[model samples]
Target: MTAWETERVAWAYLSRVTQGPSRVVSDFVERYGVVEAVRAIKSGVVPRVVAERVSARAHIDTAAADLDAVAALGGRLVIPTDDEWPAWRLVGFQTGEFGGRADTSVPLALWVIGGRSLLDVTERAVAVVGTRAATAYGEHVAGEISGDMAVDGWTVVSGGAFGIDGVAHRAAMGVGGVTVAVLACGVDRAYPAGHARLLQQITSSGLVVSEYALGTTPAKHRFLARNRLVAAFGEGVVVVEAGWRSGARNTASWARSLGRPVVAVPGPVTSASSAGCHRMIRESEARLVSNARDVVEEIGSALSGDDEQDHLFSRGDDRITGPAILVLDALPGSGSLGPHEISELSGVPMSDVRAALVMLEMESLVVRDDTGWARAQRRR
Candidate 1:
């Protein structure tokens, strides 16, 4: 093997031996570099924390074989040393770690497939995610938002599972827009199996990426680990329909931890599936987003993080539209109502209600809190 190939093999070894979010090992690799770190780990000379994480698998070296396996499938191992390593997108994992999120450790390497360049597509990506046991409303909403985002030149990203993730991927493809799937399993094996064809379609068009080795199968813990990547890659996350304790909620937390804007779609209050999204909105961290336009607005503000406040509230100066006025009047003076309640009270659909809320919030006519939406100090 060439020297570069040898370096990649070392990365493969380190990446395969342990489950990630191993901040100690990540730091060791940072301090000593991949080549030397791999040597020390193998020779049992690494730190106690690193050894505890890797000792079980350290003796088994499948780096060469795994590299060959991915290559045989027409994919490649993308290491940090490579130019297309997604450094810009994944950079937040560093700060994410310091911010006390255990799941935010930078990956040692990745296995990627498909024709599209990973870096190019992730530049403006949004993760559309929710429950596997999704409702028709959830699927419908996911499709509309994903398709619209695609048409607007944003890459739609998801976990490649059933329900919302699958809907998001297919919707993006239906519009011939870029989409990416960050898998918990090996890129070679479709974990849901039903989406084997969907995974293949993604390979033919966008990318299917994983940090695991070529044969890694999906598992409970791995899926949790995978959510961080979905959040990290996307500039924002939009939860369509999530149960109270679903992976979509986990992804939302990761997004919030990464300082990415998180948007939640409120559903019918009676929907058990939408419990998580509603709760997230109630927590006041996630923006209420009902459609693609709302998602773009939230993500646009996030991207322009350094720009003037005027940039985000550019439309704030405009006279409040009819919808905004109606939404304003729907609010109970002292208490709060959620988007759905406001929709019902104002005789407006939740999508329009969300837009009006955005305008109202910017204009200081309304505010949102853990309880939901209420009147602000003054109406603009």
Candidate 2:
């Protein structure tokens, strides 16, 4: 068969619901030409070669009807040649590390949905992932980092699951920023049905993506495999919270292997939720980030260290002297303080305090949650 026909057959085979059998067929096609591979599968001669690799079954016929159905489900079956396919995928797939197996298991096609194209969104993206049973602190930090990245014109990417992943997606959406959910399941059937609405919002504002085809269910192992794509697509990976064997840490490992920067959030010393993060820091696998600015500064420094020195969070040309600056310094990290309280704490006049508060609020430098104003976005 021609190369085009071979690729189409490979894609079609990979899109089937059956996993091992389809992979065997696809691998055979990938190794040899499609005509010979199809003949081997049909003649049952291919099973012995892959008998130790996967449980084989009869060759499944490719169907136009199934391909059409995938399209009808708002899914785009994208090949490497597609205009919207990420150029990075070519580079990523060629690496063959971290379960990527570019030689054997590179995705034949990806199913995509949502507003931003995969290629466009991945250009300025970061992955924020962690344990599904993350602590409250983990979720909070993920939201802050993801939200800030979104506002800074970077897409926040994560798997659309519970805990840190969900928090990141919600916070980005709250700020009218783009967030993409990279799923292990098909985009048509957003797994963890609880995130259905959140996934819809994401699709409207950004995208929901997966390597699986339409009507596929999420598998435990698939998510571990999915982390590779999250790492492959992002410039960096941030682990907000993780345990000894958390999947987020898996992504971090993959990111490091791929030569991307990794960042980890520091939490309470006693909390098991943060043990993995601390370990990462100790092992020199990632940098510690207390707030969004720390992350931005790191990324900016990598791009151009000079740009980082240009801005120093100063109120003026001097080190520090503005009411807003003083107010921010005085506010508590976890809770809000009213204008009167802030005025008292900063020792600034009430009127100046009020004006600074307003200005800060307008710039989203501070937020008022029922009681009073406090730092909104994390300090740079």
Candidate 3:
């Protein structure tokens, strides 16, 4: 078979052999060798371990079914060999079996649905993850950090769940900035149905991606697995609002394992929701971020170029147009605005405001603060 055909068949076997989506492809390579693994799978004589893993685990078939379902839904499955695959996956994969106690997982492939190029977007990306049961403080802080990150021309990557995840994605999309959603389930299946429309919006404007295949339904453990991808794919992981034992903490641990920088947003000392972040900061495992500019300055060296500001906020635009520029102009020199405020000031519809903020934020021209509003960063 051709290389692509081999990859496709190997993926098919991958769908069948591994119980967990995290190791499906990599394990196939480890056990059978890449080429032989694909051949064995197509020949229907997959190893006994592979067969046992596939047959015994309900998730194995569910993972494969996800691929089939996505194919049926007009979504394409992207394997490692795919041209569009993000190169950042290598960072996580290379971090295997560290001296540290914590182990981070990596996915074999990504399933993406969106206009944005995952590779292009992640060239300068940062992840913002936090509690699902976020507080007003958490949500507000998440919005600001994520929004400002987007303004700096850094794509914001996160889990596509509620609270911090939803708000982070919204902050990026609100500004027409490129954001990527790393899902625990299939790209075709939108879990947390409340975010269905948001998922659609992401696929259209940014990217909705998964390591899991198409039809796989999300289980509790899957989110933890997905968290690794979120951490691994970015330059660093920022925790905006995580509680003690929050899943976002898992992502933070993964970031630590990979030697990626971690940033946390401080919240009310008495709030249970703030405990996790405080612990991270107190432990010195994460740096504390009070606003978007801090996040930028913290990771500023990792950013591709100082010229990102000129690219994002330029007025005599050629490719960029309309609301993106207006939102850029709307940002004040300090103290960020929430999406609503950005909308009001930019005269861009509330719907487009977030996307604009994301664009400007990723380019490093704007930032969001604890108040959850976008503001222009005060440059030296």
Candidate 4:
């Protein structure tokens, strides 16, 4: 084997020997390169931190077998050295804070199943995630947002499970758009068993990715580990509906840490399934997104430049389109007016007026009441 071929086996070995977010392993590889790091790790001549994390699995070197197994399944391991590796996404990922407990770092290798490149689908991706115990309203919202995004050539990333995740995958695919499913188990396995057909279809054009080696079973910790990647792959993460302790909420946390924009869809206050989303909004951890447009705007704001002004009221921000600005300027500062009145005053079409109002409402610059729409009270 050539040097790179040998390095590929080393990457596969490190991936199996160490779980995700292992800073020591990442640093070791960065310092000494993949081949040398694997030798030192296997020979028990590494740093204590690396030793602690890899000692248990160091003896297990199924690099060749694992590579062949995944290849047999029409997949391959994407290491950092690969030309298509998405180094841009991990630009400023602060692994230290996240890895303090899990003792992991950025993904060493992603086992991916799909003909399309990982960067291609993930380049303009957004994560639409929510509760497994979804309500009719929740599922509907997830589908609408995900479908709209997919149609606009933006890929949807999500955990491959029931409810919202399943809805996102199906919606993205329904529109003939690309989507990536970040699996908690091995890519070779069909998790949830029920979504076997869904997983199989995803691999047809989109991607099914995982950190776990082949044949690894799904577990709670593995799912948590998988959440980080789902958050990372997306430029932004949208939580459609989440309960008090949903995994979707956890993904949102990862998004925040990764500096990825976090958006949430509100549900009826009475619905237990939406409580998590509401809480995130209340805590200011996530921006409230009611529709696809709101999601797009937020994601655009985050990617455009410094995100500190994402929630700030900037008159020049591109997120504030001309129609929205006109709509805002047309509104009476003290009172309210209906859409027709606003459209007439702003010289914007009715359709544009309505769209602008929704965008304004999401930005907290406008509010709709029983009477009509009015400028929201500005904070001091």
User: Candidate 2 at residue 46, lDDT?
Assistant: 60
TM-score of each: 0.79, 0.69, 0.71, 0.79
For residues 22-102, write the lDDT of model 3, one tens digit per residue. 344456565556568655654657656555545444233333455566666546666654556654334334434445432
lDDT of 4 by residue, 130-242 (tens): 99999999999999999999999999999989999999999999999998999988898899999999999999979999988888888898888789889878988999999
- Predicted candidate 2 versus true structure: per-residue lDDT over 76-117, tens digit per residue: 566554556664432433333445342224455677776567
TM-score, cand. 1: 0.79
In model 3, the number of clashes is: 36
RMSD of each: 14.6, 19.1, 14.9, 14.9
List residue ranges in candidate 1 displaced over 4 A: 97-99, 306-380
Ten-residue stretch with the least lDDT total in model 1: 307-316
Of 2 and 3, the candidate ahead on TM-score is 3
Q: Model 2: clashing residue pairs? A: none
| Cα RMSD for predicted model 3 | 14.9
- lDDT values, one for every candidate: 0.83, 0.69, 0.70, 0.84
Q: Residue pairs in steric clash, candidate 4?
A: 21-104, 21-105, 22-104, 22-105
**Per-residue lDDT of 122 in model 4:** 75
Off by over 4 Å in 3: 19-35, 41-52, 55-74, 96-105, 301-380
> If both were scored by lDDT, which would come out higher, candidate 1 or candidate 3?
1
